[model samples]
Target: MSVKNLLHSSKHSSKHSSKHSSKHSEDILVGVGLRHPHFTDILTSAKEIDFVEVHSENFFGQGGAALSVLQQVRETYPVSLHSTSMGLGSFADIPAHYLARLKRLTQTIDPFLMSEHACFTWGHLQGQLMHSGDLLPIAHTHNNLKRMCEQVDRVQTYLGRELIIENVSAYVQFDESYLSEAEFLTALCQQTGAKILLDINNIAVNSLNFEGGDIEKSVVDYINVLPIDSVAQIHLAGCSDVPHGQLVVDDHACPVSDDVWQGYRQALTRFGAVPTLVEWDSDLPAWSTLIGEAQKARDIANAVLGVNARASVMEINHE
Candidate 1:
């Protein structure tokens, strides 16, 4: 069916738009990144998975096989739309065409949740629009924070739902950054009502790369500083293991590491079973293996939060 027809049918369906729910139990909520390589596996054999997440941009096409498959997936599981291209911190305006397409996709899918990074991507160069095509870190100054708040307010108002913004790992801290990252995030939440998608792996990677003290302590400290109620979701991902003083990247390319798992537990202790995702995008694993990682997240969260015997699954894929 065409995108318009599909959306028309969905809009008048039994379930409402802008907020989709799962047929599965939410008590043990967990999900995995739904990648094309494992589409059939997810539909056929994946059980205990509360929902599935996808890069919102992937299904933005008006009418195509991808969109059709996504519509099919929507039938079985709740879909979370994770968009990397929103560039919420950019100096230039968010492109009108991009926002309109995203709006349409949200209407079609009615994702249970939607998210983007705390970084910037597109800005004006001379007179034309240019995109860096990267989730580059944003400076943590109050001036920048004001701009980000405005951009976030604009996006949320345009989409008609609250947007979840994530904290990105940075190799270098801007010298002009007078405000702390947590402070800026808190301000954004306070001003725009947008929640945070806290990635524990990013916090760990940033601490390892720049925070220069105890790794676990610094990671946990950053989490503790953020407003507990501001976190709407959590992300658990693997990072490359590096020697002391070596650079660490949020590669999301392998099994989630020990440090990240530890931070994940700490997050649950604070955030209380916030819906989490397992992100392993680069070194994609078999569907079962990826699901195993998600199960691990469920198990750890269950143990930490005193949730018992509830079936849960975690997933991998970010960006």
Candidate 2:
């Protein structure tokens, strides 16, 4: 099917669209990292948050605290499985064992959706595993886009779910960079039958690190270029400020900044209330506090969607 035709079908299908549910979930779908600290509270309490996001690598192990708590939470709220280790856009093919494990986990958990960065993680030069601990930027040339589209297809097939590609936070740029990140992601989504997990925090961090980068422009660029229907979810997180200068790191350690919140409001306006998650990784507070933060995201979404908080809360609970 063509891109337009596929989007048409997806927009109409209950499985893909789920308009009522999606809108409702967007307001309440706040997520915290599946860390050891919040496991007990998450498993025991009736979570007010709409969903939870887990790092795929944490569950690459078996029968551990992470997996155990994840399984328990998967039984209740919706889940969005974000990955740091898929290495989807890399020079290497999918890791067989890792893919197998992820496949098994998805079969069991059945997340609302899954996503990974639009950067390379693993590469082999001289027969050695030269891995970057961070999500390294990719050159958005035609050849690279071809490779990326193919890799996205492979991931979707292997996982048996649509893979959402997220923009990465980077302080450096490649001299050979041929395409803007938004344009690259747009073409990749058009080529592959994938969705987007828009990370507002990353955009803010990237704009802050490099000169001449603006969060508003990045958000607007994405809104203008990518298919609004292709957005499966949105992510909000806190970032750490770089020392010396005003460079900001994409560290999910602190609270969400007011500037990042403005970026999110822009996204809410563009995406029309896509599911948003609060991604707190380090220095997590009590479960209630996290829920409160998530509630703020919902409020922002609701306001952007032109709905009141009471009605928004009702819609989420009903969905």
Candidate 3:
């Protein structure tokens, strides 16, 4: 996941791909999270989608209808395994049993990408280890960074593939930590050869919870700070603005806010059309509605790419 390797991949994938950058940008994959209700709809619908993502824990069974559904879906499109419980930041290493199950699922589905959160979930309770069942934040310090790097390395070695880590929305920030989240993520990628799953909605939620300024700018600045080569995927989801803006929740139920969309455009400008996913989990939408969100992401990316392509052509002609 070094800059050199990413650059070579970009060049190799795009060579003879298209004269227009927009066409190359079409290579940028857009997908929706596969939920239970939409199983038949996703396979039957004629909607345009590049891939479908599933939470890895959902299909760890030896044999079941869930795995069968996934297999049927995989036959039609690529799959991505998004694990919610592989808390890489936990005090202990990733649980071997969990990793074994995930490895089997990955072997079965052959997902296009594998991802988990950058937060910790396991903690000691009265001298006994317990699962928190939620993503918990870790302080951004040198020691934590070293631990994360080691954990990431072990996971990669066991999985025999690179694992992409995602930033989670948080309710609290550590006071003693000096390193910015971006700096920590940068070093993690540089050291462990892993990539990032940039969640645009989480950025906005954090901005509202912590900064309370113009969230769109906050998102743009956050994306700008990350090394471009480190980002491998983008997640577009919605926040719950029920009670007030400050107390909003990262519930992936509503439509993506205008602010997040603006940030997404900025992200594409910086990251060059990375794989983007539109996720709606809680108040699940009809397949048509959910697919509409995915289409919007695809459209925004193509628009940005079209502008870049034309700008590039003009620059070349000027030269």
Candidate 4:
């Protein structure tokens, strides 16, 4: 079946199928990343947010005020756990300690969704473990593909749930790379039964950073080649031009650019309404401002998918 058909069927087939399919099939949700600045507001006020996402590493400790705040928020909203350090493409196995903590967090929060990047952060050199503390890109080769599949499989087994892998913004390319980003991710999902968190902002950033890249064509081609059913969520964020506009950085510090918004519209048209998130990490804004951004995303999705934004929210609540 086509991806669109599969998504539609999953929603109406049965309660069991609705529980198993991507959350988007039930409702098109738009949410904001829960940052520290808005903790007080989030805790005190009754905000109408569909969901909230957080960096998983922030809540790995045994006990703290941060965990306390997260627990409070979980009571009011469905939480998504996004990781920056899992490094599924790393050569070394994911650390046992990290996986154990992740498992504990999963059991505690029972998150609506879980995700990690398609990059590596740790590796062994001369029998010693080392970490880059950054999300480094991996070569798109057959060997790398196999290694990533193994790593993703390990993570799913540890968590006892399927995970979503997100595409990272890249400023450079490797000579050893043999496949496009879309092809690599598609193959990874086919091999491991994983899903995707398609980031439209990253596609725009990469297009500007590379030579002879056309943003519109690149975005279209990339989305078209992917296994449509593999996408479970969409991410919309802002980026900045760096050093005389020669490179674009995924800073996530500003509002979503027009180009990125247009790309997001294209994605929604092709894939239908998937749960979307508005990510603004740096230069934190007031809680109200962030909500406005999420509203913008919801409006775009509503326009593209031919659904009423307010009605969709009501439906989700009833579900």
lDDT of each: 0.77, 0.73, 0.80, 0.79
TM for every model, in the order presented, reads 0.86, 0.86, 0.89, 0.87
Per-residue lDDT of 228-294 in model 2, one digit per residue for the tens?
A: 5667778888977667576677779878888779878766655566777788888787878787778
Candidates 2 and 3, the one with greater lDDT: 3
Compared with the true structure, model 3 gives a TM-score of: 0.89
Report clash pairs, candidate 3.
none
Candidate 3 Cα RMSD after full superposition onto the native fold (Å): 4.4
List model 4 lDDT by residue over 1-319, tens digit each.
1122122221122332343243243356778898888889888876767889999998999888999999999888888899999999999888899899998987788788788999998998788888779899998898999999998887887676677899999877899998988899998888887788899988888888874457777787788887646787789999766786577789999999888898887777666667789999999888888889988888777676664434543443332
The global Cα lDDT (0 to 1) of model 1 is 0.77
Worst 10 residues of 1 by lDDT: 310-319
Best by TM-score: 3
Spell out the clash pairs found in candidate 2: 26-275
Q: How do the residues 5-53 of candidate 3 rate in per-residue lDDT, one tens digit apiece?
A: 3322223224312322333566778899999999889778885898889
- Candidate 4 clashing pairs, residues 3+ apart or interchain: none
TM-score of 4: 0.87
Model 2 has a clash total of 1
Give the local distance difference test score of model 3: 0.80
Tens digits of per-residue lDDT for model 1, 1-319: 0112112223322232211122122344688988888878876894768778899988889999888888998898888899999899898888999999999999899887789999999987798898877788989988898889888877877777777789999877789988778888888887887788899888888887888736678766677777766787788888767787689877888898888888887766665657889887887999988889989998887686664212211210010
Best by lDDT: 3
